[model samples]
Target: MSDHRSESSRPARVPEPADPPGTAGARTPEPVPAGVQMSKQSGTPGAAVPEPPKVPAYARQPHPRQPPSPWGPAGRQPSSDLMKIRPAAPGVIPAATLWSVLATALLGALLLGDGIGLNLFLVAVPAALAAYFAAQAAGRRLRPWTAVWAVGGLSLLAVPALRDAGWPVFLAVVSAVAVGSLALHGSRGWLGIFLGSLGLLTSVAGSLGWGAHGVRDRMADSRGRWGVAFRSTVAAVVLLIVFGALFASADAAFADVLGSLIPDVSLGEGPWRLFLGVIGLVGALAAAYTAAAPVRWDALTVPPGPARGRLEWALPLIVLNLLFAGFLAIQLTVLLGGYDKVMAETRLSYAQYAREGFWQLLWATVLTLLVIALALRWAPRGGARDRTLVRSVLGTLCLLTLVVVASALRRLDLYVDAYGLTRLRISVAAVELWLGVVLLLIMAAGVFGAKMLPRGVAVSAAVGVLAFGLASPDGLIAEQNVQRYRDDHSIDIQYLRGLSADAVPALDTLPEPLRSCALDEIQRTLRGSDAPWYATSWGEARARDILGDWDPGARVRNCQELGSGDQGNERGGDGTGGPGGDDSYDPYDPY
Candidate 1:
């Protein structure tokens, strides 16, 4: 009874109030930290608790900033609108571009009727000048290096005015002009140059659409006077045609005067001139568009390939270098010391020995260059040691390959001396020499750097080709054969006969029958109706002058006899008539 009375005396236990409306179950109970105790009202009674864990300073710091995503917010794909190609700003075509197009069309109409000669130079130079002015009018600053390519292209275009060989010079001129167009903007690296040249085709096609758009915009503008001018010009043309036809039909004198004043548009010549004019107009528009907004080829950078492991990269190159060194050592021994003894032991004549391996060496030199390029592309870029190894191995390989180039050239020289100079022989020798120059450039790049090597190589090739055209390859071939004939009376009359008018002066130095035989075809071509001044070349003019005072009738009989004797010898001389017993070989065959 006393215990019960004490319990009741303990402040009659007060009941807790209920939670307010809308408050019950609204909040989740807070999570207790590890080793932290909860109140008795929230947890089981009499539960044991421990100390809380320690927090590190780094964990308490704020998070660092993150890079923005390439996609839209929350990682969605980009919007389609962003990916679409925007149309060019609405504006009329520049007046300078229009003037340029008109000038180009006029030049084409006047000059293209004649064949390619001074016409090529006149057409090409004016077009280039027009493009420059158009670029300036478009407010674009010309690149400094543009002049180099322009000069190179213009100089090449002048080849037709000088040389008579048709195909090679034509190809060189086309390549130079294309590369020059690309340079009006700018490019970097080999890939940029290649793609930029290719892009010119697309630029030309796109210009049609671009010009159409510009015309539409011009027509839509109310303030433009072009529409009025167009209508008035059409009306004037229609009225003039009606009145002129009436007056021409009324009187014979008026008809003759009208016929003289207006050019007769023949079915053949009229369409060709129109087509040429259209081509010129299209080309001018393309040039102007490109100058206004060129593709940024230099901005397109290629990421480097994966870096290679040191051993994986170095071992193969080292082996290649050693192989080249071994081959070069043998070449040096044979070239410098025992050339005659080796030839005697091999039982081969000088020409046979020279011809047998010269091509192989040339191909090897070319392949070695490709290998060096690939090595540089995949080379390790980690440390100084890797750089050193690259320089030593590749540099040594280049040096050895250069010696191979020398050997190849020496062999070609020996072959030419034994036989005679042909277009094929001279062209290949020039290519091999240019390849040697490329190797020297590579070695210099190794010592310095490779940043400019690609452009340098391209520029050198252009210079080489230009020099080749200007040097007059066919002329040189004829001169060499003439000198050879003087040295030893061995002459290939048939080969000289096949050459163009550029060889006329050289062939004129020969005696009567030989000169008559060689100049027969060329003289016939020149003696035809003379071309206009715009269509004449220096070589053709010179040929006319040289043959002006000469007569072919006196030597015709001797030429026939000489030709019959050569045919007799070819058929009866042990069946091994031509040089090196290769009777089927054509001197003009590039291969």
Candidate 2:
């Protein structure tokens, strides 16, 4: 009895952990089926069953938090990414990339360094650049395009060698800049590069000007500067050629501007006035197109083509430059009265004119800029702008065409003036018309489309024609006819080269028709070997064909047979006289 009582009072020995749900208890809990949970037991005999191992922090929980399988459960990937860490799929191409790259590559290649080479190189550069730019712009960003850039870059290395031979350094620099800028896709520091270039040019030009005392000396010293500047300006021009930016309405606006704003400048109701007026009218159209232009920095954008190279900024810049040049000429005329040409003494004639022209261009620039601002600030989200421009241009064209017809009908004697109804005049008018239409269309479409057509061609032709004509048969002819001693000397020398005999036959001296027969005879029998050694590059083949009947021996013998103190002896009576007499002629004595 004492022992039982003491045992009962003593604390029970430490109890064991409750068995896991399916495991046996001391009595062997009635074999619980698989699905059913085992009942809890008191610790005394079976304490309230220990809460199911209060979810162990590290241990895998039964629900949802299933352990990863050895079976490699992830689904398969695309074949492109077989590597350890898969790469991203190729990114979408930008819509403008093709156009930009094409323009950059072709223009760079074609106009590479702006005629750094000789005659062949001049034609080759622009063509090559155009093709390359076009190809890139269209599509096909092939390895070939990259190779073109490399070739252009490498060509720069040859500049030093070509320099003394008359190859330009500006082209080399431009080529190098283009390749490098394009290769990096404007990613690498382009700002640093442009600043460096500006520094180089201004510094070099200033240094040359300072070193040389006179304009003559300065020009000789800085031919390289001019060359470089020209190329760079051309490259800059390439940026301005925005595709498709003009119209008929714009032409009317420009006509109004020219007619009303112009000072006492008299175009005088001649064909020339109409021709030039038409061109101005076209410019107005282009201006209108510029007004509604999208935001694009032609100077900054690279990767070349017609759009990027020839169109984007090229046309507008040229117009600006020409205007500037004209204004300078006018100002100079006002001050100096006569001297306008850029001769050996007056090197900055164009620059001087350009300075004044800047004001006129400034007006246009401001007007266009305002339009652009309006576009940005409050452009309506519709086609209202397009419609308005279209109507304006169409109206202008109708008026211009009518005026042109009226002018043509009024002039009968002007036709005799040669230039009145010539192909050149017609071409100028056509160009104006086309430009006007383009400007109007561009106002509707914007800058991107404006440059795609014949804008540059039309404008250049119109201006060039005006220049040539203005300095032409009337004004230019008289100017040229004013022969000083030096001029007379040059003419006498040319005359001597073709003069057949010491005494041209009376008939040969006659102006035309009957004189041609005698002239032909002299050319055939005497000119090749006699008094005049007729070996001009021009007409050499034609002269040979026309004068082939003359006896070479007789011609040579007569040339040397003159009984005077100085006779132009041909052949020196060389025994080698045969057909055409050794394929050479005696030198013509001009003095």
Candidate 3:
């Protein structure tokens, strides 16, 4: 029993692996799966140990620690969640851009002194060309549609060169330029067009920094040449001052020659020219930058409003249609069969009858447009049934509103026939006509999908403006009034005097004193110091040619006497201080 215990107490021998011949001193470790503990066996000798399941190589690597955030705990955000803010990348400005900007500056100094005219067209041309070339140099693909907008913009810019109408033409030109710039890369929605146009101010502001950077880089690259040019300019200026004074002191004839050669710029004029030059430079830079990196306004997405139930959507529109239909029936009755009867009942004259409800009808037409726009926004978009309902109800309302537009126009026509065509009357008539066109476009849009409706409306307005400018509103007003004067042997000498130079041709056809009274203001304007060739407009040039030989001073003295004596005999006068009398009449009043 002691021998058995001794044998059991003896330590069991474990097997040892032999190393290779050259690596005998170092023992190789046996491959073990990660995360599996290697515990020594205590039982039978030479028994094989079971292996643990293998772990993936990726799982075997330790996790990397994150770096500390510089912004602190609260300010720290996940990398994926952070929005990146980047400055506009500097681009290589084309040589054409620099030269064009210089040209624009010089032209602005020369032409903008008088007023806007052909000068605007002349200055804008180079800027536009530079933008086109810069866009090409920047490797941007010009959209085909953008060419149309550019053409339209240039055409509108030419309006001041052709017509002498004041604020209306200016507004049209401004709208065209802003919208055309936005469309350079093709905007998607009305919001995109509006916001992108507004952002142009910011673009112009940024151009200063961008242009300065570009100039600095260019100067750095051509430092030697730039220094030479700077020194040469300074030397020339100094030489001219020193030598010019000596020559002027020596000879009075030379001084006269020098005086004629150099323009006499006033202190205020110098700053004005400098301001205009800065405007030109900044405008060209903005155009270049915009063309190079146009905002992707088309990428902006506006989700539609949530759809409503068919009944919920169609009910109000149906009621609106019914209301429009009722108004239409009444308009038809009053306008067609009951005109004389209604006039008799109201105890109103022709002009009074036409002017009474004209404004209310125009407002109704405008408000109807707003209603249609809102209805389209919230209209049901479920299926075929909903689309049909929208088409039917909205279509009827549009048709009825068009009739209302016609009625408004008819009333204005009658008013013009009774009183005469003033700018106010013709302008409102044009607006009513445009609104009628808009309604027709909307009706067409309902038939075809409304996806392009916004753009369509913009295009229509542009077309309308172009047509109005081309037709020459002031000229048309003059022609119509002249025709009325001839037909009735009566005219408003005062009203024609307020017209621009565009009316000169029409007014020149009037007899003697009337012609002189109408052309006096325009002749005085043209007789002033002649504008530079670039600043002169076609209308002003023509006016000068027409009034060159005729003197208005002698005839204008008779205008007051003639106007006062004939005031009561005006066509629409009732001789009781009525619509036609000078005291009661206001040619400028829109309503």
- The regions of model 1 sitting more than 4 angstroms off are 1-91, 215-267, 336-339, 549-551, 554-591
Worst 10 residues of 1 by lDDT: 566-575
What C-alpha lDDT, on a 0 to 100 scale, does residue 260 get in candidate 2? 36
Candidate 2, residue 241: the lDDT equals: 34
Candidates in order: C-alpha RMSD to true structure: 14.7, 28.5, 10.7
Best by TM-score: 3
Error of 1 at 287 (Å): 1.5
Can you give the TM-score per candidate against the true fold? Answer: 0.74, 0.23, 0.78
User: Model 2, range 1-591, lDDT digits (tens) per residue?
Assistant: 232233433334566676867656445432322333446655545444322223345544465554555565555333422242211221222223222323333333332222222322332333234334433533435454345444544455344222211212343445454442332121122332333223222222332232123335545767997678669978876664322123324587755544332222234534443454333322222211111121112234333222222233234434544554564454444434422342234454322322223233323433433433333233222376643443343333333333333333222112112111222333333434343343344343353443433223322333333333222222121122122112221111112223222113222233222234334444654344321111121123334454456443433333222311222112212222221112123222111
Q: Which runs in model 3 stand beyond 4 Å of their true positions? A: 1-90, 224-268, 337-342, 564-571, 575-583, 586-591
Per-model lDDT:
0.71, 0.32, 0.73
The best-first sequence of candidates by TM-score reads: 3, 1, 2
Best by lDDT: 3
Summarize candidate 3's per-residue lDDT along 532-582 as a digit string, tens digits. Answer: 555667887888788886677677886765554543223344442224533
For model 2, give the 10-residue run with minimal summed lDDT. Answer: 287-296
Off by over 4 Å in 2: 1-161, 164-179, 184-381, 384-591
Candidate 1 matches the true fold with a TM-score of: 0.74
Checking candidate 3 for backbone clashes, the offending pairs are: none
Model 1, position 428, has a per-residue lDDT of 90
